[model samples]
Target chain A: MTARPKLVLENVSMTFQSDGKPFTALAPVDLEIPAGKFISLIGPSGCGKSTIFNIVAGLQPPSTGRVLIDGEDATGLIGRVGYMLQKDLLLPWRNVLDNVALGMEIRGVSMKEARARAMPLLERYGLGGFEYRYPGSLSGGMRQRAALLRTLLVDQDVVLLDEPFGALDAQTKSRMQEWLLQLFNDFGRTVVFVTHDVEEAVFLSDEIYVMASRPGRVIEKLPVDLPRPRDRAIVSTPRFVAMKKYCLDLLHMAEPADDLAA
Target chain B: MATKTTSLPPTRSLFTVLSLFGASDDKGRPIRKLPVRTLWSNWIIALVQLSILVTIVAGWELGATFGLIDKFFWSQPSAIFKTGVIFFTEGDAFTDIAFTFRSTLFGFFLGTTSGALLGMSFWWSRNYARIVQPYVICLESMPKLALAPLIIMVFGMGLASKVAIATALTLVVSTLTAWSGVQAVDRDQEKLFYSLGASRFQVFSKLIIPACIPWIISILRVNIGLALTGAIVGEFVSSQHGLGRTIIYAGQTYEIALVWVAVFVLSALSMVMYAAVAWLETVLRKGINQ
Candidate 1:
């Protein structure tokens, strides 16, 4: 028998009330993510990409449908999935170590135990000496790393990353992407990444779901056949370029369809 | 072939000479130097401030000695200082100081604790907040000192009355300020905590309370002055001991020097209270960061 998917969304949809009028943000959609797979949702602005992350993170209940974790119905359940938004969202008052330990503490871990668990990760994540420093004092890259560490320390099986590297400079973004790949591989957790960058979608995803706005819906599923242990050089390869071009074309097609819907 | 013409030295303007006293830059513009980092060390700035105070006191003494001002109406600085020495050494000044300090402390603690708790409760319950907001605004606008007689009648002419008045003066402002702070907590941070499976109480303790600390400290600073004002006002209405009562008695008996001494003591008390709050803020912030 085939193993059950790690996460499943059965006919999830969202509609918001805008100025007393019904505004559909997302059409009913279904998604299945296998255990330990890296999936990405690529779309334009207003495509409800973030809405999906919010739903998965259980920040908002979907207007329709159910969420399942390991085939167990878990709709509207929060704190079961780790989510890292585009902004680091680090608590300014907390030092780097304390911030990283926050999730564990919330999960009923003692402060001493949480700190002990967080201690090794700080050095591993290259935040060792700066652990005692406030978020305000850290650089953009360091702050994002600390945020990612916070998300990871939560010990969730499914991690939802909403354009996690979107705000970084090109060099930092590329570096973080590689670091995330290794981290995910080591952790073996299923990840659902959302991004507007087609190249980023192609580079990081095992499968990319192309979405269109104006009542957001998945239009295509493009699987990346790139070899394992992909590097920066893979991005310039012919196969990688071809896949990127195909996604760009799909996105361009999605725009006209969005306009028609508008 | 260049002509060997000699250039004359530039004439120094009057303003240029004045700038040597750290009033302006080399440009000779009429600049107002604040006694900050530009021209002096911090200690030097403090010394300059001290010099200004000494000058004022010297002027007052000279004016009284030369009969430019009546020593009877406007007391001499030296006489006031002598009166201050006597008040501390021989008079019941220590008892009055202790009484006023105790009243202010009691009011400050009661007002701040109740205000913070009420503010957090209001934040927790929007319906209650909506119902009470108008009343809070109205009470805040009312001059608390006007209720001195009522407070005295209720609590009696003792420490309780002074504390009650101080609490009245402090409560409304602290409540409103703290409520605004709670409201101003970053929405994203709240969502983060919620998404982490934090209960309402956990969110409050971990996020809201820590987030509202700076505002609470600011309110504490403000409440200190207000509490003192309440205590002094309560004493003025009816009290056997306190700097306020002493001032009133001195004024009635035409003891201008004694009045000046009491006023100086009150000023010192305010400064010490303010410094204590500032120290508390530093300690609290350090704890948060750690």
Candidate 2:
């Protein structure tokens, strides 16, 4: 039998109470992320993609529905899955090494052991000589890598990335995407990524979910047939272009008239 | 054109002076040459400061010599300096200094620790914080000096009274600022820790406390002055020996020079205390960040 999906969401929805009004941020939605697969949720602004992430991360409980990890109910339980946001969120008061080891430290690993474990990862990730440098002294790309290291150090199998590289410049972003892909390949972990960039989604995902806003729901689940160990050259391929175009069309149709006008 | 020509000579002289102070680039262009202003070296700044101080002292001495001002009331700088020397060399100034320093140190430590702890506790409990908010505001607004007699009455006329007043003065503001600091911790960071399965206490000790440290250090800097003021005020109300008591006794006997000497010593003491707090901030920050 096919391995039970690493993470499953059943009819999960979020309703935020704003100014005494019940506002539906996300409608009932179902998602299944298979083990050792990379899935991307691509949509326009206000698509409640981040809302879904917040739910899965257990930062907030879903107004309705359930979350399951390896078929076990984990509704509203925090610290069960790794979550990285758009911002690096590295503590400014911490150096690169300490920042990377923070999650493990919080998980009760002693500081000395955490640092020792982090050293090899730092060197492998090209952050070795700068391990003791403060986050402020690092470049944006380096900070994000450090943040990813922090997320990974805790040893969560399913990692949720919410536009983690959205703030990066184009060149740096491309390089980081390749680095992340290699890391993901090596780790063999389940990744659920959220991004508005179609090309990014097409480049990294094994499967892509096109979401619609205004009571957000997944409108389409498109399988990316791109080959393994994909790189920048893949973006130039006709199939890649077709996939990107397909996602763009769905996103365009998903946007509200007001958003189009602006 | 006429104004530019007239300004040229002075501007050139200023540049030359700045160049003399090593403000020139490799190619000999004056670095950041402001037309009318000359960059002063640390030595020059020190010299200018010393000159101003000397001028003030000379003016006071000359005024006293010429009878332009009443030396009995104002006390000439020379006589004040002589009294300060005597206090250091021949009098009980050392004992007074030691007593006041000890009281200030104790008060500073007690006030800082209590303020920081109370602030963190408030951060941990919203209900308790809300209940205590109004009372804290009221106490903070009430001039701490007004409670000096009561503090002295309760704690007695010794070092304990001085420390009590100092802690009282510092506690409110330090608690308020530190509480605000904890409140102002980045929402993302807090969420990050929570997502990592950090318990509420873990979130507090790992994230909230470390995040609020800069604020705590800043409050400590402010508390140093407040603590000193509290200690002196306590001594002023009732004390056997302290700089405050010395000043009071000198003033009562119209020993104006001795009073000036005490004032000088107090200012010096304040500077030393402020420097110590600043050094602590640097060391703590380095340790935490590293």
Candidate 3:
């Protein structure tokens, strides 16, 4: 537990100006993600879960405070983290192979080399025959898989996944969760995931950060004691069930306070 | 509209022929054999289209023969066809067509390329776009053909002036359309680019330009017609060559059949250009879009 944190959000906060008035979207907060941990941030809509992701991705800088990566102050700086959003956001025009090659190509790798590098990942994942298919023709689950593979190929140590499978159906979502667990381990990358489903958070995360809205802030941080290299079957375990129950209880408790003054 | 006028009656004749052969249609639910019906009717529709042309030409020919209409004014359809054949075979009609074609194509290429380039550059600076947008609207709202006299005066009533007029008509529309495409770009994709450490130039070249292709392709289709109109109008105003000038010459001499010949040639030229644009759109959009 004494391993130096991979990422730290020191007193991070956000306030937006709306209609000539001040609106605090996120209250001051400090969070540390230990190296190589699967962390989840679960909160209701507008709880600044996405705000934190935007700040961490450097798409938006926090109004105050800073972010640190490898103990280096990396506040308001982009390209340090691999970020995947809710929508797959695949270019409708590009086929799966080219889409997967985008991140490397942007970083000055020759397209031929980048494409050669991406080929094996496509084969290993479920997209073997779909390398030449356009995004519009792909099934939703397959598109998300392509998108996730694209992010993974970016090869950043820390990855931010915001509701990556939030749009999947129950059966597909379950299947994706199992697949993602495999990926998380095989890739050995630190991930900060944002999701609303408590069971999903409990299933995948090493630590879960529960957030409260109305001047959004972190309310609870629970460490999962479940053994490593988990599978979907573990969700039925009493320990997993209890952990999920505790997180759900925290979220519901935070909900009724939504009417409180900001 | 052609189908509505005379195409439907042929279906009755086909039904009569089929019924005579004991071939009955389900006409009951119309759910089955639906695609078969479309496939069957398409051929009939094509034949009917040919019949419609025959009917119009026969009517015009008969009218000219019997004096229901004046051959001097309407000109016999066969005479017009003969005149067209003669012009193409023995006269300089092909030269005229080539002149109009060159001016239209040149104007289209120059206007769309320059206009779309300027329009897309607006994405580089929000302040620049805000300042320039109103002027674009003003230019768009004003009738551009009115500038023909000035353009002709500047370029001198030659191929250059015709190209200038065509360019003037197409430029503003392409500017507005390309600018709108830039504005409507998906913010999520833009953010994704930024997240990938793409520089502003990379975002512009790789993302913005490719994403706006459909819009630009649409502009291509529209601008081709406008360019033709500009070139013809420029010729009408003043020109030594082109199909438009030939039409003016034929009209002044009251050579009605030659006027009809030039008009038909212009129509054929417009169709060829339109077909070309449609093909280009398909080819360009195939890679970037579904």
Candidate 4:
């Protein structure tokens, strides 16, 4: 987990033409993410966390910024980057195994080989024997797991997850966070996760970037110093509560004063 | 609704047992060994419906036989049935039916294929959509029957004119359906395909096609009926042979029974085509969902 910065966004900015008017979604920003680290970007709605993630994934061009990968200019790294959107976005017609193998299929891997690689991950990730089921049959949590496996099956080093559990039930969301932290620790993959939930940012990420609304820019970066192999009980710890408070205060989100973050 | 409730209690047991045995009730009844009383009641209900139909037919036959109504103006069912017998046995009506069937089917094929291809092409390129969309609108809005005489004059009063008319009707419907189907696909689905590293062509081929198939199949089922109408209309306007021409010929000779026979044949053909398309749609949906 101590590798050099795998992805660096230098002075990245985004502007969109909405109804013939220029709307700046993200102001100029600079960030560097090291390899094998889990980073969360938390912000209000319409904040540019998604815009920034999209730019990094090569899905959209930054108005002004240079994205570098491994100290080299990454002007063309579209296929090399893996992304999971807020929506599960699973193809309803496709079975779980095929959905996960879609990335390989596009990369020209034969069907047999793609399935062989995707099936094991499905089984290992608590989706065993459910490979043949369609997306419509899976619950929200199961679907999100299938989606993560899809992103992982692409075998890309840098993964962008945009509120992957935003649509889950509260209990399921907590379980998923612990599960993801364990998986991240095992795989040692660099991840940039975006979420509106402050406690989730503190629970799953090593560093949390709190963003402000309207022309979204990163205002604060808080580091979580928790030990590895985090579990659900970590939320009850004093440090976890303190870190979540700091993030909530930074975002200025109004809420009932509760120690649930603890 | 009240009838449905009263009927349910008696048949419930029979249905449960028959369902396990893999039997389907079409006339709303299946053989049940233990539910003999329920089975007899089911037959009673069927008999009542059958009696209603028989009474109506009997009254119609009696009126024509007794000259209570002018049989020369509107023939009886028996007269129509007699004409149908001649049609099947003498081979005279078969030739006419075959003529109309061939022309209409050809037109249907031409219209649907061209329409679907054009619709897909338009969807793929906005520039093409912009350019050709107005022309399509004008063509679709135009009264197509007015063009039939000119079509006959140009293509000659042969099978081609009938085919052209049918094609004209079918093509518009197909194009519109295909375009709307393509547009109705979920945006998230498209993004899903793209994130999988699918190229533009692959996205269109895999995601777009599969999502729109149900819509396309529904359009096809509708087009089958439209194709038959188009063919009949074409035959009525200008054709030397076919069911439409036979109707015209019978009307001129005051042979009302023959005209009624042609009408029934046309309707029966449409019904058959509709059934076939419905069966195909079911099979296709099963395969896609699976």
Best by DockQ: 2
Candidates sorted by DockQ, descending order? 2, 3, 1, 4
Writing each residue's lDDT as its tens digit, candidate 1 over A1-262 gives 5778999999999998999999999999899999988999998888889898888888899999989998888788889899887888888888899999999999999999999999998998779899899998998888989998899999999998988888899888888889888888888899999988888888998999999888788999988999878888999999999999999999898885646578
TM-score of chain B of each: 0.82, 0.84, 0.84, 0.79
**Model 3 segments more than 4 A misplaced:** A257-262, B1-40
Question: Which consecutive 10 residues in model 1 chain B have the weakest lDDT in total?
Answer: B29-38
* Per-prediction tally of clashes: 0, 0, 1, 2
Q: Give DockQ for candidates 1 onward, in order.
A: 0.56, 0.66, 0.63, 0.34
lDDT of 4 at B195: 60
Tell me the lDDT of model 1 at B126. 83
Location of the lowest summed lDDT over 10 successive residues in candidate 2 chain B: B1-10
TM-score of each: 0.89, 0.90, 0.90, 0.87
lDDT of 2 by residue, B1-290 (tens): 55554444346666667798777765556877446866889999999999999999899999999999899999998899899899999998999998889888888889888888888788778899999989989988898899899999999988999999988988888888889988888789888989899999898888888888888887878899988999999989999989998999899999999999999999999999999989998998777667
lDDT tens digits by residue: candidate 4, A1-262 = 4677998999999898999999989989889898888999998777798888778777777899888877788643466678898988888778999988888888889989999998888888889989999989899999999989888778888888999999899999988987787779777889999998988888888898888766778888778999877877888899999988888887775222342364
- RMSD each, Å: 7.3, 7.1, 8.3, 10.1
Cα deviation at B229, candidate 4, in Å, is: 0.7
TM match of model 2 to true structure: 0.90
| Deviation of model 2 at A211, angstroms | 0.6
True lDDT of residue A107, candidate 1: 98
Worst 10 residues of 3 chain B by lDDT: B28-37
How well docked is model 3, in DockQ terms? 0.63
